[model samples]
Target: MLPKLGTNETMPLQMTVGLTYDLKDDYKDAGLDPETIAELDSPATIDGLEAALRQMGFTVVRIGHIKNLTKRLSNGERWDLVFNICEGLHGVAREAQVPALLEAYQIPCTFSDAAGMALMLDKGLTKLVLQNHDISTAPFAVVRAQADIDGVSLPFPLFAKPLAEGTGKGISPLSRIETHQQLREVCTTLLQKFAQPVLVETYLAGREFTVGLLGTGDRTRVIGIMEIAITDTDGLYGYNNKTDWFDHIQYKLLTLETEPALFKSLCTLSVQAWQALNCRDGGRLDIRCDETGQPCLMEINPLAGLCPGFSDLVVLAEMAGMSYQALIENIVNETLHRYNLPQPRQRHEAA
Candidate 1:
């Protein structure tokens, strides 16, 4: 804890929270790749998150970019903290840029630090870290160009995607390839398109799940485990499908009554990944079962989407008995506690 609130403050202390995210603009007209734009936030995600913070009694400040944030702070503006969700536009460390900026100024912020975010961006690097910790992840390789395809050690039915992308970018039904020709063509396409090394992994054809986590260490808990089922058997939970999830995706809450051992295993794997990554505040861990039904980590979203009405994070949160407001408030409260800052008081009237 850095400092606590006191003195002549009335109506509880107010903390200025700078809400930040990358918005998907009219990129297609700009000739920007729409596939890359899918990772950016929707208007609903930004609006709903902003509304949640204001409802929690914090003074909300809209900070959209690192340059803008710096200019404002230099012009005598101050933000007690930043609510960062910037899934940056370039480089492997793009996700780390804003958090690194805030840290340099000694300003507290939400979500993981720069290193953690950077690690989470690269699928191959994240898997390496997991392997170092003796965690189970599907065997994977990185292909930077056409030459690398011939060296792939993984067998057929391999999954390929951009090494550092989220929101299902570089992932589609075509990502699952069964032959070396398919692999070569897909790898070449992804390399040229995404302009990043492509990660090729053994495809786990079993059940897929995503688990939500909150807080840190002993306080950390699994919020809920939700399985995404694709309505179209030929489709995947890819960018196209995830974007229009209403018509194609179904979210199932894993219950002990129905899943029993699988549910428990999912939760366990999620928490282990959370701890391994040294994740802070809120996060989402995606997993898929191996041929033996053992869980394997797919990806980690430390800056999990908070799209309120939609977003799997919201569904998992609601299942854990936490309202949208509570979810946002919980994030603020946990980050505040980490910084030793005074939290907004919860006052009870009459009753």
Candidate 2:
């Protein structure tokens, strides 16, 4: 049970927090595609996360990749909690390494636990989990190869992409298939090109936004919903869009104008997804509207980005009136609270 804060009492000195992210050095051996590795070392995301934590007065230490991450923790390095940002080394299980290590060490951390990471990383499984819970997700099917696309029952105009990669690795405008033959070709490309299962889902062709949820359980807070305006690009946030293809001339961002009804719905769906996966600390839940403007789950990003200016989560935080410091502080406190760490008495502005 969480401890109730008593008035007129000082919390103790804050516990040390550690940080880990995919390193530039590990890019080659991380088993990711060459192009993918380049983006993994983008520094903007991991460095931004560390900078924010340091500003919160936490003694943040950065470790690179999963190579020896587990061994290092076993060697008596004490951390009250780990801020895990490892997207993974290779395979669908990549995102699960950090949390699994931390959990084995009896140390707490932020973001989704190992199982949640595994489930969410596999988009096909994620959809099934949501469907099993009766949560409305995009209608979808899984194909192991191009030949397996014959019996897909999803509505026309489907989206096909690698079911397990992140950062929009294999997605492109070509991923959108309007006919059965097109769908088969796309699915085959994903399977043969990536050697992974392809996820085919009913495309939601409306607004794109992410719901930022922080903390967990009874105290979880919805930071704010961020709308993605991809006007300069084509219709997809595919590999090219992520790589800044066409310099974003076709991409643009739209304003919700702070629609109250939409905001509430985004919050509700994000929280439901978070709770369904038993996520803790913070994570990002992706939502999209159908042609009729109804919100549905697109996917959940357990390891959301923290790029100083580019990350959607930080962008949402900025809009929600949270400085980077406060955002990091909240994440730290939430993690500490999970393990019942004694609260710190003093509030110091970290340099």
Candidate 3:
């Protein structure tokens, strides 16, 4: 087991980290919808991550996506660890592609493993796991077709989205339905457009928040809780709001002084969900309150966006007075400690 680093302690090691990512620009001309590539990283994101890694004294290698990674691996290329942020473009197991490949080669990688990635990608499956563990989540059902919509016993005013999508790919003003007719219409459109099952859940009408976390298993800790206040006419943080967050959203960092009980509840629930899902390294968990003011787990983002100052996680870190470099260092430190690898020596005094 690796020893935890104290404030003045450090592990001296020189390592080469292979970075795996799917660039949004690479697929802009692939005849795909804009939402399809929204979760993919930008060139700026990759550049920022690479710079952070190099600053901490690690050799950084740009290994593109799974195709590029497969080619390199087949040719016997390897690294001390793979910093994977690949949101693949295929099926339910898309996000698992890179981690699964690395696992097969007995290589260590950052973030969750293949099983966790596959399970978390499917929103319906993730809710099942959460329910089984007695975790608080909204009542939901998966609709695979138009016929399945009739079988949904959930009450009206339901929120529906693609069963296995991220970055609010299938969410819109139409997602929040108040009638059976609207539900049917939205579900039909989503099923046909996304080619995936629709997850219709009892709509949580209260405040929305996302909790940032670091570490894994028993070592996992909550970094901060951020309340996502939607300022638009329609109160849904869909793709458009997320893409143009500057104008449509306000992110407030919660604290014990302002929201004592709610803040604790959100942190406790987020950590429980993260541990139950066996997520590694770091990520974020989205939570929303119901009509009765009870918080419910919305989803788990095990591989969250890392676009420096733009991503939610980065924003949360910044709000908490944690620098971007420190956020990256914390993630790297947690991974190294989990894997019993030599950790990086502290380079900067700021956090």
Candidate 4:
């Protein structure tokens, strides 16, 4: 059972939570492409999370965008804390925007801070950080413009993706470039489609996994590792595959009990990346095996998707015997504890 606070719990102030996120409709209004809007949090997610917070004795407020947040907080309005999942509409620093604002206002928020989110979203920079720390990741280079791709040499059978994008954006089977022409075509396409720099890395053709992590530093724990069998994804976990994953793909618990060494190594590397990136509260890491049958880091998501029944992170936790509510509670409780506040017991109303 999760730990609970006692009657003598310190700092017993009634909690109020501010929920912030970009909605799909918000993107529609701005004339963003439907595919791009897929990154935005669904209404059901906001509702489910708000209901959970209310159930836990928190008064909740919905702040949809920076404009509304500015109006409220500028007028001296504030919540005890903010539950932020705002995938900003544009820019490489999109994921960090809300958290940056929260820090400036001195209001605590859930998940990672600005620096952590920024680092995780930038794939090439993230790999560099991991390499500097001696954590194994695929060999990679970045292509900012078409000229940069000229005479480029990393390796054959390379993978290209947007440097800063989530929800499988800018990724497709065509992302795997086996020749110079394919590399030039895909990188140029990604640069146009996402309007961001492209990351070109050595392709890891082995099995892929997404690991859910909770807490921070020594307290961090691997919730579970989810094996993603991209059966119909043309050998790549591309955009369509992720969007229609339930229909076309398979999800499985991946302990690799027979290969205990690989299993243990996956867990260890995930925690290493989490700590190296200074991730707090909770997050997810994408791990893929190298040509040598050893697991290597791909990317980390400090701002992991939270689509209730649909998100892979939630599925991973469920595979490990945790409910969606419990998964959310873990994030909430971890954030509270980080502030040195006692956790409230699971609240139940009178029958």
Q: Write the per-residue lDDT of candidate 4 for residues 73-121, one digit (tens) a residue.
A: 8899888789999988768888888999999988889999998888788
* Winner by TM-score: 3
- Candidate No. with top lDDT: 3
Which segments of model 1 are wrong by more than 4 Å?
A: 1-12, 26-31, 346-351
1-351 in candidate 2: lDDT tens per residue? 123446654443454667777765566654656656644556666677777666666666776667666667667676766787887657788888788888877777788788889888999899888888877788888898666799898888788888888768788788878998898778877798778899888888888777777887877778777776676546666566655534552323223464777777777777877888888887788777887898889888878877665666776777767766666667667777777665443253311
TM-score of each: 0.92, 0.87, 0.95, 0.94
Candidate 3 Cα errors over 4 Å, as ranges: 1-13, 348-351
Better of 1 and 4 by lDDT: 4
Provide the lowest-lDDT 10-residue window in model 2.
Answer: 249-258
lDDT of 3 at 105: 90
Between candidates 1 and 3, the lDDT winner:
3
Each candidate's root-mean-square deviation in Å? 3.1, 3.8, 3.0, 3.8
Q: Which residue runs of candidate 2 sit more than 4 Å off their true CA positions?
A: 1-14, 28-34, 38-41, 245-257, 345-351
Give the per-residue lDDT digits (tens) of candidate 3, residues 197-218: 9999999999999899999998
